[model samples]
Target: MITAEKIFKSFGTCTVLNGINLAIGAGSTIGLAGPSGSGKSTLLRCIQGLESPDSGRISREGYPGFMFQDFQLFPHMTVWDNILYAPRVRKLFPRAYLEAKADRLLRHLAIGQCKDRYPTNLSGGQKQRVALARTLILGPDILLCDEPTSGLDVAATGDVVALLKSIQNEETTIVVASHNLDFLVQISNRIILLKNGSIGADIVPQELEDPIVHLRGLCD
Candidate 1:
């Protein structure tokens, strides 16, 4: 489980997160949605300790893994190398186990054919899958994604949604931050809307007649 209380953060003069409070249960998939500058990324960063809040407290029960917005795969390494590098450096698992896990993840993500290719040669969606495989290889209890579907076509976006759903397990928590409401609605069980550094609405998608319309405030 993860909980935040009265969280506040700023960058010099511009305040980002303002007195935010929320709780996330284990195995829940949460989507943080808002317009640009709405604090979605900041909140994810804070949760993962990439940025510290000036006030309030956040408690996380397990290890958190972050996937950056840019899909930061190493340009110098092949896909296989990129996915295995972190665990190898940390010595978290034996070489054979890591290799096996990487192979399985690549196959599961439908990128097995690209394992020998470099990031420069792969498409945006392929890079995203590689980054995901790298993060999943570490077996984190909590996974955070930032603008996961930013640069993909409709088919690729669908692939991402399906891949994410396939990886969902009772022990792994997933949090995705994106401006795309439709994408979030498809993948997240709960959607939290942000506006002007504060939560505008916290919704259970299944409870609403139409989550996207409600999230957009189209109905009275």
Candidate 2:
């Protein structure tokens, strides 16, 4: 499980996150919902080891992969090279063994056709998909995504969302930060609503409906 204890964060005079506590179990998806600047992305980044919080402690018992909202692909690297970077960094296995693993991951991710393409040549959805493939190549224990469907059209969002669902079905921990409440209800087994830099509501799948409306009232 991934857990956080009494988390707190501030920037100069503005307090961003205040005393958050959470436990996310394995093989489940949790949705984080809140208004702008509510610290949803920050927490995800902290979990992904992209940022250090001002104060707080977090513990992850397993490896975690993070999908960035901006599709942070290496601008100068080819798709294949991008996915191979992590394995090389950790020396996941002998070079030949890791190469075989990368080949299998590329095929599994359905990006084998794009192995030679550069990030700039792919569409937004394709770029995100490539980012997912790169992250998954590392075989993470958890997957954390930030606003992954934010700018895609409905059809594209459905495609991306379904990709996420298909990946999660294989029994990995999934956590997503999204503004789309309707979609969240369909994908997440639990929901956490953040309000005024703290947890406003946390509930299981049965209670996630109309979360945005409820959050609006609380924020007002």
Candidate 3:
């Protein structure tokens, strides 16, 4: 579970997030939709603690697994190392537990064959798969994904969507901030429209004909 209230943030001359308030339940998939510069990405950074908010409190009940917009993999590190870094660094679990989890996640994500390969040796889709496996291996209570399926072919996107859904079923709450309304509509349980750095619309699955169009209206 997570709660953020009255959050305000700006970058020098421009105000990115103005009075943001949101709460996400366990296993919920909340989609953030907005125009290019509407602060969706900035809000994600704040939630992940990458960017400090000027005001408001971000209350998180447990540790989160975040997937950046770009798959930030170490080109020199082998896939296994990349997936093993989190638990190994935190010393959260036994070495055997971490290794077994990493191996299982790589296999479940269909990237086990690439375990010995360097990032440079993998394709765009393969790299993203590795990133997802790496993050999942950390066994986060929540997941923050920014434009998670922005790249890769349609088939690859589908695979990522399925994986995300499976993760959600396993009780990992997911928050995905993206400009791709169609993709968000395909995978999200709810959509929150961001306009002028504020939440303008929050629609559940049973809402109107097209949530994206309704969300776009907030930009007007």
* TM-score of every candidate relative to the true structure: 0.93, 0.83, 0.89
TM-score of 2: 0.83
lDDT of each: 0.89, 0.79, 0.83
Which model is ahead, 2 or 3, in terms of lDDT? 3
Which pairs of residues clash in candidate 2, taking residues 3 or more apart in a chain or in different chains? none
Please write out the lDDT profile of model 2 over residues 1-220, one tens digit for every residue: 7888888888789888888888888788999988889899988988887877777888887788898888889989998888888788888868887678778766655567888999998778667767877887777789898887776677766766676677675458899998887677678888888887789878675664666566556656
Candidate 2 versus truth, CA RMSD in Å, comes to: 3.0
Q: What is the per-residue lDDT of model 1 for residues 50-167, given as tens digits with 9 covering 90 to 100?
A: 9999999999989899998888888999999999999999999988888998988887778899999999999988898788888889988999999888877787778778878987
lDDT of 3: 0.83
Worst lDDT run of 10 residues, candidate 1, spans: 211-220
Candidate RMSDs in Å, in order, are 1.9, 3.0, 2.2
Clashes per candidate, residues 3 or more apart or on different chains = 0, 0, 0
Q: Order the candidates by lDDT, highest first — what do you get?
A: 1, 3, 2
Off by over 4 Å in 3: 95-97, 216-220
Model 3: per-residue Cα lDDT over 9-84, one tens digit each = 9999799999999998887889988888988889888888999899999988778888887889987889999888
